[model samples]
Target: MKTYFRLLSFARPIGRYAIPYVIYTLLAVLFGALNLALLAPLLTTLFGQHENAAAIAKPEHFYDVFKMLNYYSMKINAEHGLFRTLQFVCLTIVVSVLIGNIFRYLSERTMENLRIHTLLNLREAVFNNVMDLHLGYFNEERKGNIIAKIAADVQVVQYTVTGTLQVIFKEPLTLLTYLVMLFIISYKLTLASMVIIPIAGFIISRIVSRLKEQAAAAHTSYGTMISYLEEALGGIKIIKAFNATPYIKKRFHEENLHYSGIMRSMTRRQHMASPVSETLGIVMVSGIVLYGGSLVLSNNGSLNAAAFIAYIALFSQIMRPAKAISTSFSNIHSGLAAGERVLALIDQQSQIKDAPDAKPVHQFREAIRFEQVGFAYNERMVLNHVSLTIPKGKSIALVGPSGAGKSTLMDLIPRFIEPQSGAILIDGQNIGSVTTDSLRALMGIVNQESILFNDTIFNNIAFGKPGATMEEVEAAARIANAHDFILATEQGYQTNIGDKGVKLSGGQRQRICIARAVLNNPPIMLLDEATSALDTESEKMVQDALNNLMKNRTSLVIAHRLSTIQNADHIIVLDNGNIVEQGTHVQLLEQDGLYRKLIEMQTFSAN
Candidate 1:
């Protein structure tokens, strides 16, 4: 119930729709009930039971609704002819139906608006919260599952939660209105009919008792299927290249079959409720006929033949709403299942957030200091007692084999991942005491994988700087040596790059990435193997561009190819999560340690 109501809050100002809908629905139910209740008098009038004109008595008060309707009807027949009375009754029935349908239509329109509004708010909330989560959270969770929660699960919640609102409010009132009319006609028959309802409700409840459990399982199955589909699409090239298409297809097809089987089971149970409720209603109606008919035949009976027929008619229609309510219960189980998943996402607290007294960092002047920093992932340590200083306007290059924590060390400067032990200071201020956005604003990064969106080259280059002019973008491009190749494309700077700039060569993509970094014009640059994946010719061009980008900036380069960083002001060689050597490239080589050994290995591999 807590999760259900939390989902409902997204339908805020619910009163706007609720109040008007109540008014419309109430009027609709009243007129519709009156339509069925008037059947007795219509029959009495047509049968000519009160043949004499003077025998008809007028109703004393309007509070007795049925008596008033019956008296007025008889009075009209007394004054006017039989044909005129029939016309009056027929016209009243037509007007009642017309008014009832109009109110019902208005109520439906209001509910539809509520549905759309709830969907918009719920989906937006899910997506915004996802975007706010820390970078590490995405690593631990499936991308496709997140997509399912935001898109498919939110849609399910919208229909189920809001649809249940209509069932909760309108259906019960309708059922009550019918019961009142039935009681007014014959209290005994109405009481007998009441016994069957609780029995029907119990049966329906038992049938749907396991529905919530099944619904939860179905949600999981569907999410898994979505994950498989996303994986297959994202790695389609790898699958085809390695001739694993058959294996991938078989895996996805298995998940699809499992999802379909669960859905089939859930729908089977859901559809069974309606028929069961209807059958019970019919059995109760037959019992009512046997009991009520005996009363009419006996001398002490209060019901006339005409009122008895109308009572049965109203009683039969009672099951319509009852059946609708029962079916909604089954559907609500599915909705609440989905609601739990969505609310769980909304309720998840992000692990990374700024301190209450955190301040903004407007400038970076001196150096980035790491003091006895250590980090681990679940007790597997990555960086241990690692300390380094990057002074102002100087280039520092880190050379190491894989798992040496070079990239992890650079990530700490911007607080991408905080150290479990020790502290990092930016310009003498602990970065933890600064706002993440303001701290990140001081640096630019380019990774081995060039991250470019499928958009125009100008837009991709000027991504973080909104409202950047073409002149600024071109200047950055020229600095990265990307201007000439960009101009050679079909649309020049305006040409749309395919996903991750697939339309361009590897060197061109790296240059565009470098251009994007240069456009930021930050004081500090973190280059992580920017040219490691390119050919020999591409590497030379990219390395030259990198030199231009790092000029006069405080730069930290993680060098995969040793030749690129031979001229760096300082070099730090790391192995096994510890810094083994630190000096200028020439100074480290002269020491004849691990740095010189690595250079020999690479030199031999190249030859």
Candidate 2:
């Protein structure tokens, strides 16, 4: 119940829909039960048993509904004849049904609106929270599980939460209305029949006891299957290259079969509740008929033929709502399980957030100082006591072997991950004291992997600047050496680059990335091995573009090729998370240290 109520909070200002729905549903239920209560009067009129017809008077109390209807029905029959009274009764039934159905329709439409509103809010909240989470969360969690929470689990919560509300409000009102009519007609029979209800409820409860557990497992299994699907699609190239199609298929098929088995089990249990409740209802009805018929046969109670028949009719409909309530219990279990997963995601707190007194950074006038900085991953230190300064309008190149914490250091500049100890200052102001958005806005990045979207070449280049014009994008492209090839495409700048620019070649994709960075034109540029992944000719073109992008910008370059950074104004050599050398490229070469050895090795490998 706690989980259920928490999920419902997404439906803010619920009274906007609830008030009208309650009004319509109450009217519908009242008229619906009144139709059944009028059956006795109709039967009495048909039998010509108008013993008190001449003395028929208006009922003094409106609560004596059956008497009022019977008295008027009899008075009409005596004066206007049997055919007219029968016609009048039939017309009343028709009108009652019409009004009842109309209100029911209105209530349903209102509920549908509420359902749609709740779905919109819930899905938006989950997706927005996901986007706000820190980068480390994505590394620790599976993509498929996140997708399931946003798409599938949220959908389940929509139906479950709204459906439970209907069951809570509308169904019980209908059941109560029917029960009141039955009690008014014959209290004895209604009391006797009440015994079977608890028994039926008890049986249904036992049958669905394990549903919540199974539902939770089924949700997990489905998420795993989705994960397998994502992995297969994303890694199709590798699977084909290694000829592992059969293994992948078999693995996926096994999880699919397990999911189907759990669903089959859950469906079996869900389908059983309805039939069991219905059969119990039939047994109770039989008991009511036998007991009420015996009373009519003997001169025992206030029960008469007409009223007793109506009582039996009203009692029979009690199971429909009863069955609905029982079925809802089973369905709510699934909903609550899914709701927990969604709420868990919404509750996730990002490790990185703006400080309470954080201020926005506007300009880059001086150097970025890493002051005795340290970072680690689960006690495995990635960087230890590292300190370096990247001066404004100067190029600093990071050269090192693998596992030298180069990428980690660059990530810290953007506050992608916070350091364990010490501080990083931008122009003597702590970066942590600045708002992340403003801090990131001062820098442009081009990574080894060209992160282009499946969009037009124009849109991809002008991504950061939303309202950039054709001239600006074209100029950026020309600066990055991408303008000539972009025009060679069939659509020129409007061509849709297929997923991650799969439509373009290696060199074209990298230049597009550089063009995007150039368009941003920030004071600081971080280029992480931007040309390492290209072929010889592609690398030369991409290197030329990088040079254009780095001109007059405070640039941090991570170079894999020894030849690329030999002219860097200042070179920092990192090994085992410490800066072993720092000087101009020629000065480092003359020292014959780690920098010289790396250059010699790369020179040897190239030859």
Each candidate's lDDT (Cα)?
A: 0.87, 0.89
Per-residue alpha-carbon lDDT of model 2 for 14-45, expressed as tens digits?
99999999999999999888888879889988
Off by over 4 Å in 2: 48-52, 299-301, 603-607
Evaluate residue 558 in candidate 2 and report its C-alpha lDDT on the 0 to 100 scale.
87
| Model 1 bad stretches (over 4 Å) | 48-54, 60-63, 297-301, 603-607
Candidate 2 versus truth, CA RMSD in Å, comes to 2.3
Top TM-score prediction, candidate number = 2
Error of 1 at 601 (Å): 2.9
Model 1: weakest 10-residue lDDT segment is 598-607
